[model samples]
Target: MRKDWCEARKNDPTPTQMYYAKNGVITPEMEYVAKVEMLKPEYIRQLVAEGKLIIPANINHINQIPMAIGRAVKCKINANIGSSALASDINEEIEKLKVCLKYGADTVMDLSTGGDLDEIRRAIIANSTVPIGTVPIYQIIHDIKDLDNLTPQIMLECIEKQAKQGVSYFTIHAGFLLKFMPLVAKRKMGIVSRGGSLMASWMMKHHKENPFYEAFDEICDICAKYDASLSLGDSLRPGCLHDASDEAQMSELAVLGELTKRAWEKNVQVMVEGPGHVPFNQIEFNMKEEQRLCHDAPFYILGPLPTDIGAGYDHITSAIGGTMAAFHGASMLCYVTPKEHLGLPNAKDVRDGIISHKIAAHAADVALGRVGAIERDHAMSDARYKFDWNKQFELALDPDKARELHDESLPQDVFKEAEFCSMCGPKFCAYKISQEIAKIECNDYPKEKK
Candidate 1:
């Protein structure tokens, strides 16, 4: 096995501090990510110092590339593709990963819960050029013959194994302590997160403290050594609008707040993951509370799906919530597929989910005044006005799909003469009529009635 990069750098201050203490020094990772994001190094450094952003670059994971998550950059989108015990096809999962990447996902998480968890994780890490994140508790719980078999040592071993495999970040459900489990027992969804549910069940069954929470500092030490970012999981996130912003959720968030501080102190990069389902009215409050409570660590959120009724259209619901969440200061939007609350997402569902979240991320970037957001929109509008079909297709979030749909709607032969599209046809082409009127009015007008 390779030596841990973070352990080699452990004698030095943390990456954030390294940036803050600087005399204009920049790491290669910082420079590369800055160029990709079109932001200055100093600006990125400032956000890091303020604890409003994170890059999740594990030193051990040399193959793991860097991407910024913060207010100052383009909002980032994360696509989750993984297998479960009930359904584990490694090749299908890889195809889904490709689909996400092709559709413009900024990051990917392998939430696989079956089929040689270690092998699946290692395969993903090897194939992924972008940072890969995982929930270590899944493996821990999956390995147990009985729920009662779970212990702190088993959990830590799983985390260490993944860390060794070069997982850049981990969604440690350390916030789900025994003290907070009772609060969630009365929740509407009652622990919707798989990791959360597993831990909760283990704690309730054994009548013991959550090992992850009880040994958080130890977990931090291990993570810091590997330079893996700790994504403090929201074990009690509201699973439906009815449960949005309830006491149980807030109670777990309070624990996450304290844990966030601890992780930062250990120089472990940290982000807070949030809600499963939240109403439109409450999304802003949830974002604000997360920033306030988590000390402004980068906020990663799931759909927070505004309503629970859109079973087949949950992607739309998630995008709606995601746009609001991002605009309100959520740093990362985890794409939710139509299969949400239904079944495992297939490749098409993954693509649809990624494209929807991409739209939400870009929309939020435009709203937040990020560097290139509005310019792209204006460029697309120009393409539309000029009837530049190629340019318009190129500007789309999913260019292939856009072009395919355009072909289906209007074949090339039909519009060969005029710049008008099939949607308007020849008789009612608004642009054509507007142009004709402009020419006639300009040429036939009488001296402006002077």
Candidate 2:
């Protein structure tokens, strides 16, 4: 359906939604996002034109259902799934995609570093209904093998190929410059990002500036052709609490701001990726800095985990940070699963990660007072007060899990309507006693005035 929409505008120089938005045309993509976000179509278009939001609807991604990410919309979550050098297959990645969709991931990034990268991405794009993203450098380095021999042309070629394959966004690590190499010496983790580390090693070996930074204009041209948005990768993002909000991270962020403008100049949509680990106290400063530095282009961040010790439960830690990040103005939260410092995430890990970030995003929405954000919370409160178990389960983020835990105790249809669970029992139920109190009908209570 979107293919037809782009077909009609085949003669246009740029196929980007931002292009159409800047021209005062509200494309069908904007209307679709408006319906989903409960905002006016014109408002969506205005945000897109102003570079405050991004609708990553690549023209070639015909199967994609457009979604908006920005401060004006509800905070979004992204789940990363792909094959690494050791494990996972096409079928496994597909299963992960299904889990992401089922549990409310706003987007999915195919970070497959091994196996058939092209085939895996093609399968992911063909099967995905949400915007698909990738780091082209991963595939480029995987194919090239020898970092010293890698060329700018090869990098652009890989990115363009992925763009044509319906990748809705590319995480280009343009901010990691050659000058920042010395700064890593002062850090504990050094360069933690795979993309960042690769770029650093290549630059050191070749003694050249970041190819992505130098070739950014060409990359923008490619993105403009396919309407794929640019997710400026944060190569210098703090990897640990000790490194949080340091010089390396801040330096790269400044460059991200410059790249954001450069991409926007060609009418390419842009969102800047942020830090990997940030203390809770610094999340607000980091978010606000992105707004000021990037000129309000959407900010997407991974865990930004506040503490460093929650190794196994980093998902929970990140969710705690994610809430602060979103509340402070982050547009999207990339989930970190329990397997995060341990290993690759399985389908169950994916589900757990998505639910945690989903809750974080929703809580941020409620805290920010986005329209109707708290209505569901209010509904859940009412359900609990009335002892409506089924309704409570229905409103839960993970209904099956909620129902499963409830059944572990009750496990009977008779308890479906029972006024109390095993926790309180009918005799000790506060809800039951509260209802009885309402019926006391005290004569001293004030009566309605006539």
Candidate 3:
């Protein structure tokens, strides 16, 4: 279906959504997003034209379903699943992708640094129904083992190669400037971002500016050709609580802001990536500052884990910060797994990560009162009150897990209509008692004389 749509727009020099929106032409993608967001197509076009929202529907990614990411829409979630140099492979990554989609991940980034890079990415993109993103530098770095052999031309080629292969977006670490090195040197956890560290290494070794920044225009041209979006990577994002909202992070953000305008000038879509870790109190500031600095180009953020102590449960920590981040202004939340800072995640880790972020995103949407957001919560409440076990399970974010927990004690079909769960038996069930009290007639109670 999307191939047919792309075929019709092949004559346009820049077929990007931004181009269409700016020209007062509403594409089918805009209408699709409008229906999903419950807003008018004109409103979606207006937001895209102003660079506030992005619909990452790459022309080459014909199988992809269009999704809108912006402060005005329901907060989205991204699951990072890929093979490492030491563990995982294409099949495992694909399985992880299935889990991601099954659990409601809004986007998926193929961060595979191992196996056959081209084959792995091709397989992932071919199979993905959601927008697929990649950090082009990973494959470039892996293909060229020696940093000395890397060139700006090589970087552009990698980006173009991936874009041609139907990658919906690229996380370009172009905003990390050489001037920020001095500030990074004073940080507690200096340069936690993988892309940031790689850029910093190249800059320090060459004693020159970041190559991504230098060739950003050419990269934008590639994106415009394929209607791919640029997620300007926050290479200087804080990696720890002490480094949260520091000078280095803010400086890189300013560069991202400028890059956003440059990308927009070329009629390319853009979204700005944000922090790695941030304190609870600082999440709001980080979110708002990104909107202010990046001109509302759909801020996408990582866990921004509120604390540094959660080793095995960074997903939970990230959820805590993610809720606050999305509630404030973040358009998308990147899931963090239990193996974060420990090891590469497995399929189960991906599931846990996706569910955690989904909870966070939905909680934020409910808090913000987005259209129909609270309806699910009300339905869940009604189900619980009526002892509708099946309804409650159906309403749960993870229905299988919810049913698993409930069936741990009473796995029989008879318990499906029970008024109480494992936590409270029928004798002590409040809902059951309330039902009994409501059944009594008003005449049964003694009344005082007026």
Best-performing candidate as measured by lDDT:
2
The digit string of per-residue lDDT tens for model 3 on 52-161 reads 99999889999988899998999999999889889857888889999998999999999999889999999999998999999999999999988888998888899999
RMSD (Cα, Å) for all candidates, in order, is: 2.9, 2.3, 1.1
Model 1 spans with C-alpha error above 4 angstroms: 1-25, 413-418, 437-443, 446-450
Best by TM-score: 3
lDDT of 2 by residue, 77-195 (tens): 99999999999599999999999998888899999999999999999999889999999988998899878768889988999999989999999999999999988989999999999
Q: How far does residue 329 in candidate 2 sit from its true spot (Å)?
A: 0.6
TM-score of each: 0.92, 0.97, 0.98
Please give the ranking of all candidate structures by TM-score, highest first, separated by commas: 3, 2, 1
Backbone clashes in model 1: 0
Write the residue-wise lDDT of candidate 1 on 1-450 in tens digits: 123534455575444332331335555666666898888877776666555677777665666667878766778889999998899988888888778768888789999987887887777777777788998877776788576877778878888888878888899888877887667757667778888888888888888888888889989887877767888999888888878899888888988999988877776777899998998999999999988888888889998799999998999999999999999988889999998889999999999999999999989889888877799899998887777888888999999898888788686754433487768876888877876777785567767655
- The segments of candidate 2 whose C-alpha lies over 4 angstroms from its true place after superposition are 444-450
Question: What lDDT does candidate 1 reach at residue 144?
Answer: 84
- The lDDT, on a scale of 0 to 1, for candidate 2 is 0.93
TM-score of 2: 0.97
Number of clashing pairs per prediction, in order: 0, 0, 0
